[model samples]
Target chain A: MLKDITIGQYFPGNSVIHRMDPRMKIVLSIAYIVMLFMAKGFSGLAVGVVFLAICYGVSHIPVSLILKSLKPVVPIILFTAVLNMFFVEGDPLFQWAFITITKQGLSTAALMSVRIVCLIAGTSLLTYTTSPIVLTDGIERLLSPLKKLHLPVHELAMMMTIALRFIPTLIEETDKIMSAQKARGADLESGGLVQRAKALVPILIPLFISAFRRADDLALAMECRCYRGGEGRTRMKQLKLTSRDIVGAIIVALTIVAIILLNIFFPLAIA
Target chain B: MAAITVEHLSHVYSQGTPFEKTAVDDVSLTIEEGEFVGVIGHTGSGKSTLIQHFNGLLKPTSGRILVEDRDMWADPKKIREFRFKVGLVFQYPEYQLFEETVAKDIAFGPSNMGLSPEEVQMRVQQAAQFVGLRADKLEKSPFELSGGQKRRVAIAGVMAMNPKVLILDEPTAGLDPRGRDKVLGEIKQYHKTQGNTVLLVSHSMEDIARYADRVLVMNKGKVAMFDTTENVFARSEELAAMGLAVPQVSRICRGLAARGLNIDPNCYTIEQAKQQLLALRAGKGADQNA
Candidate 1:
């Protein structure tokens, strides 16, 4: 029953986005998010919508998957939209006993909802196209400059890679343990709050024990391989920015510039 | 009466997505009460997925499962009770133990059934005895026990529920020879004494040949063969084609048969092979005397 989580999952594909340099993809993802926040009106949001559509088309990732990633944050989107609709004060469109709806509030609410959806879709594209190993490699390389400040960049990346690799293993282990417990009639579904929390005792204890056991084994295996921290380590696949990456960067730069110009020149009527 | 019946059952994993694939496909079988059935298949052949359906652990994508002629999904609310009646001990069950003491761990199932404390204690002791665990060891923490001992405790935990039809998925997996024998022996004893149905899922043909009365051969998510142990082993070549093999004794018998010896190729155990060889010798001696 714990299999519904799709966060941090990567989809394998042979698209241009997948082929781009991982570091460039990371930068573009951050740039896309910043562009969404910088946008002000319908014309600006239109740029984001067009950019995301182009990305979806080029990545070959199904639109449904991008929407699936937004499922968990749907409540937050709705909550913000509702709050903005009723709380913002401007030319009132409708007035009730204790509530008033304004044109500005309605416009702000629409803009906020569109911005949130675009923001999630844009970031999800990064993870969908790039594998975890490549993503971490990119992150470690990007953060390498911070080593001058004594930050453990390589170690942190190593930890993240290990964690990502074990997610599926731990999930499969948890599934097995849950089935074993359920076969013995452990009531996990029906119970009060306290009873439910108590039921987790049987699952949690075993899970924690196995996790530690796995960690110990991994440490031993790493020691056997002489894995001395990230110092002087060489990678088999070097990350290099090619002509395609430069062209992609140019397109993103042009899109961001166009968004800024559009926000300045083609402001929405409500704003 | 059939202890369990699967009718045209099919299970698809991650349906409606790119990962959609059928794990079990239109499989149907009937298991009689008090019978020991062995399910053999290669990895990803749907052996694990099929057994999980017996206890309502997995809902069939199409068709139904009947336990004692009653539809298992007829009353979804009481499905937990069905689990008590059809206990499933998964592979590497030792990892499921969590209670502080072995006794409490064994009692977990019975307590979940809301039995009286006294009855729970009685069942726990009975299960421990069945598994060859000493009474004194019950007070110790489960974490303190060795790997094989911890596995026994986990098995006893399910046995404490006294399920009518016990399904074990590779119970002997990862155990040493002696440990494997001990666990399999206890399962045989439990079936014999309690007269309850047992479904053993294993990849080892020898284990099934020695213990199972009937064998169910699964191939590519379908039931390829289901018959008496002798009959299934008789078609060892077909099993081999499916990436399975017969017992070593059966292979030896097949070799003798190939050399024109009048021995049954289906002789699986050592005792059967010995008798076949002795009979062949007697017939040869009689012919020479004539």
Candidate 2:
């Protein structure tokens, strides 16, 4: 049952986006998200799509895999699209007995759906190209400013890093536990709701106990190694932005500017 | 009846994806009832995947797993029954113990089988006894028990189901020498008393050699060899080449045999080696009568 989980998740690549400093990639991901939202019209949306596509291509993550990653969200996408199609006010596109779909609503829903898809695909590129450790390190560094605003950025990043590192380890542990229980005839599947949930108690209780034990061991080991909080911790591999990052940033900046220009010149198409 | 029969079993995880790799290639083997079979292989040689097929815990990407001549996936709904028929205690069994008390933990399995509350209690008690767990430890939380005790509780959880074919993957792993011996002894007793088929998967050839009557060797997802323990151990070189060692005693005998002393390299147990050495000594003494 646990084997269905995807691990060994970080795709190996040497593309331009992969070569960018993780810190830059993290920054660019946030910037791309901001652009996705600030995007005013279809033209702006098109720019975001084009830019994300370029990033995805540069990261060397197959477009098919990115689409596959979207599989879990297809239902949500459809729901949001249906809601948008019925709610937004504009010229009517089609009408059924009690339901009217507007032209404006259709366009808005299509644009919003595409935006959501691009946002996900763009972020996935970050996760796919950059290892979890680097991503967390980038997050910690980027959020360092918010540290003054009581964000606990360091702690959160540390948690994420530790959590990511232990994902495979805990997955392995869960696999062992599942096999052990399955061997004992713990019918994890093929039961009524309550029965199945009750069956999970055996698996969960043990996993929770071990998780706590692991946490304690980790804390003790950290103390033994004199690991203080992020106060003065020196990174073994410091982040450095390079020429590729500059080129990528310039290209992204130009795309955004062009999007804004198109929004001004062709305001009605966007409006 | 054959306890478990896997025919042309193959599994490729994440099939059609770039990450897809065959964890278990085409492999076929039959484990007969009341037999003690040892499965030895390197870490990724597919031992775990193979045993998983026995209980229908994992569906083979292709091929069939038969339990008592019935295909495990015949009904698909009967996989749970298959699990009860073929027990699998994975490595580090302690990771599966979650009940408040050892007693409840041991009872978890039989209860899942839709057994009566009373029958579940009986099986739990009997299984704990089978694994040499003390009556007093039954009330203690599984988390509070020592590693070895937790291990027994985990194993007892499965044994409570009273499976026809019991498969243990490294039952004594990470245990101290004494703990290892006790666990192994209890498992052997359980197998003997129940007269159940046993499949032991271990990296340590000594563990397999000591208890297993038959052995199956896996390499690169295929069966390298499968035969009586004696015959399998005879190919010590091939096993060694696969990074699997022979039983320590058999290995020692081989070294002695290389020094011009006549002996059987097929003896896997220490007792057999000791008896052979004594017989040779007696023969040498009788030769002086000439």
Q: Which candidate is the best by TM-score?
A: 1
Q: In CAPRI terms, where does candidate 2 land? A: medium
Task: For model 2, state the Cα shift of residue B216 in Å.
Answer: 2.1
Report the TM-score of chain B alone for all candidates. 0.96, 0.97
Measured with DockQ on alpha carbons, how good is candidate 1?
Answer: 0.84
List candidate 1 segments past 4 Å from native: A263-271, B260-263, B276-290
lDDT value, residue A264 of candidate 1: 89
* DockQ per candidate, 2 decimals: 0.84, 0.73
lDDT of 2 by residue, B1-290 (tens): 78788899999888986778898999988888999998999989988888888887789999988889988898987688888888888888788777789999888888878989999989988998998888999999888888888888888888889999888989988999999999889989998999999888887788888898999999989999999989999998898899988888988998988888878867889999999999999999999976
Instruction: Give the range where candidate 1 chain B is weakest over 10 consecutive residues by summed lDDT.
Output: B257-266
Candidate 2 deviates by what RMSD?
A: 2.9
TM-score per prediction, in order, is 0.93, 0.90
Best candidate, DockQ-wise? 1
Which residue pairs in model 1 clash with each other?
Answer: none
